[model samples]
Target: MNALPRRRPNPLSCLAGSLLLTAMVSSAAQAAPSQQLIDAAKQEGMLTTIALPHSWCGYGEVIAGFEKKYGIKVNELNPNAGSGDELQAIKANKGNTGPQAPDVIDVGLSFGPVAKQDGLLQPYKVSTWDSIPDDAKDAEGYWYGDYYGVLAMGVNRDIYPESPQSFADLNASEYTNGVALAGDPRTGNSVMMTVYAAGIANGGKAGADALNAGIAYFKQLKDKGILVPVNGTAQNIAQGTTPIYFDWDYNLLAMRDKLDGNPPIDVVVPSDAVVAGVYVQGISAYAPHPNAAKLWMEYLYSDEGQLGWLKGYCHPIRFNDMVERDVVPQALLDRLPPAENYRKAIFPTLKAQSEAKTAVADNWAREMGVQ
Candidate 1:
């Protein structure tokens, strides 16, 4: 599968390398974009933008499609710049430039609030806004998650003939020191979601007692010298330098295709528990073309827009619509955890997420020197 275009790159190159996930098709009950939003976006003529962090390679297809459909022009910026830098670039260029700033911003869930608080983000809910679940979007319409990734442990069968089923299994001496840590949670957005996943596996807020279990899980792997740190690809795992990895389900699944043999890789959303971590997108408060930015969001969440995500392997946020249309492969659908299980998947409310942010950072610093 092709890589989706990344919005911006961060300095934490190492941690950014390992996380992955795929598309989601939201419900038709969810709001669909209005013809007006679509028409206005086209009139804007050009859509200039930036997407934070980077991931698979198919995003260009989405951008290209939107431009093709609307006859609007889109210029996606580089993927190597961090969100901080990308935001600064827009702030720095305020009012003077013709391009102004990006029409949209895609980022990790945690950072969405941070950007909102920083007064960096603008709010505009697409006409089809009602379709988004409350938890998936801001009430004020500042941002909404287009898709998400569930945390899953991936084993490089080449390195470990035996696959790991749970975090407890991962901590076992047999697999100890063989797993690769995704890198510092502080610098990488996806890994931050991993930390939150660890929280869910340990037991949400009630899992405070088990938080140590989560910490010890990583500690054991680290102390065993079995845990290897890698970014997005499975190069280390495939080469047998690292036998196990924990990453976004979509990422691990996608990476397996790059290997030569079956490679004995298994990625499972821990039945032990899971978290609904998200990658979000929203219109820039100062978008060069606000209408186009709103249109982009509408397109992304629409049936056509979400299909690209499924084709690319990111689990679509809205599955009911996609499955009916057969946008995703039945074979792929079979690989996913049950939909009801998704409801069981923990997604921290914004307040809960804010708390996790500091706690995750502080704990990582104290426990793994990650911050």
Candidate 2:
């Protein structure tokens, strides 16, 4: 037995054993790299973000916290840009490793799949991925919803003493030329969601067919001279130029605070329908600082990060989860609309959203005579 040394289990077997060991080690090395990622990101020392307005969803605090926590500098580009602009920036700066490139984006929910399809987004699931709702995230992690807002009617009480409580109330003769939208539904996500909410209020559902009802509703507003052509803004509301504006609850809430009793602003999620729209976060496919992007995602989805959004009046995507875990502060929770108000809140399926968007784009001008 000692003579052959048991043939050493054969030379070919030894080679196979060595290959298996190498593969195992490689896999282990690849799988356990959280600390490695942190180190690499620290070395990079920089990140680039696009279209993140400081006021939107509390991004200012988030960016500041991230920089302070990691000592990484974040270069924000086009803070006032729209979701469409964000996608264009990614395409325009593709393959560029300079400061101009965007490392991450937070876009409207409809734009998430579009970015993924264009190969502009990379898959990255944060540590809190499990807590996120299935409907709010891509299965493969290409993108995930960070926060959502309900479409609400914002009324300047100085202009309309009796605030509109329902979408139907906006159609009253008294509200003629009073209703305004944040932007054209053809181009703005908020406006699009407003139209969708109208559809839901009018006995229509949330699919392709339902979109026609939305268009019809807007068309009627336009015909009755109730729909103002001007884009709605907090300034416009404060000035009484567009007293009754259709906008996200968060925006209206912030506006109410900014107005601060000079002209009381009232926000009401239409009693007839409560519809919520989501904003998604994604890492750029060509991110120059990939690890830093990952770290940012982790921060955005963490309890601390979700709370930041809450501080800004936007509903975090994991709000329900946070409530269940009792992680949400009682004071903050109290500020939110009573839970019963959200009982009827409806979210359109991704397919329905795509179809509805197409419907809006195709017929908005024809139906309402405004593009």
Candidate 3:
């Protein structure tokens, strides 16, 4: 019978096998598009950032490094604007395709969900998404914390001779007309947290309903003539105009170099209460250069980015992660206060923060007699 023809594998089976293999290859290829994203971002060639001060959180170096690495130009707007100003810029420039419209924003932590609710932000998780703490990020990736700092007392040593180490010390006759806040409590997150910290020192808990103690504490400072009405600035601190500032630790730490230590600025995390506040990053809903914004996000969360913030004395959100990985530099680590100081650091819950903001805004001016 002509030597029975060798049985042939089914042609249909071979075709189906080829198709499945092709699909698998395509799926693997689509797994990550980081390189594709870089190419697209390069094509965009420009990024717009709002309210990012080069000196704040090492943004100056971060922006320079990004520009050098990608050859994309960054247009920084309103370097001195506050978190509220950043949000306002996005809303004001909505639907515009110009440089005035911000591509990314770094705002007070409480503003993250607010932006998300207002549809001002877009969801985009970075390659290191899993590395971020779940509680520090939005479920849909609308925003994630970049860095944080503790509210501390920054005293001009030349003016005070001896620095106050506790919130209660500000009420002493020695600090009369010396105490000032970073900004108005009614609108500034730093100022609000300062009050919150004071309240904690006065036996108040960290909750919306528990801010009365903080309010009373500030009222006492005002009554004693220790609370200055002017906002504390580096210039004011250097000139001894606002010799004792209740501000962020990073800001005070930066003043040491900014003022050349003429009088020397002493930063103290109060023994009674250590309150920490976070700053969050988000991509604009109407980013003119979307890919570049995404790339910026990736850079900010990367090891290089986190270390950059650390260099500026701001604790990166991934600070603990860096510690575990042994990636932080020894010098930078040494600059921070002892671990014990942060052991009692208390971060407000989102609900608590919103409540606290409202409480401050509604009662600050009325209670303290300053707008």
lDDT of 3 by residue, 263-332 (tens): 7888899888877888899999989999999998888887788888988889886665566656778899
The alpha-carbon root-mean-square deviation between model 3 and the true structure, to one decimal in Å, is 13.9
Clashes of each: 40, 0, 0
Which pairs clash in model 3? Answer: none
lDDT of each: 0.61, 0.78, 0.78
| Model 1 stretches astray by more than 4 angstroms | 1-60, 71-73, 78-101, 203-216, 258-264, 321-344
Cα error, residue 214 of model 3, in Å, equals: 2.1
Error of 2 at 340 (Å): 2.0
Candidate 2 displacement at residue 8 in angstroms:
55
Q: Quantify how close model 2 is to the true structure by its C-alpha RMSD in Å.
A: 13.2
- Superposed by TM-score, candidate 3 places the C-alpha of residue 78 at a distance from the truth, in angstroms, of 1.7
Q: Work out the TM-score per prediction.
A: 0.75, 0.86, 0.88
Model 3 residue 360 lDDT score: 82
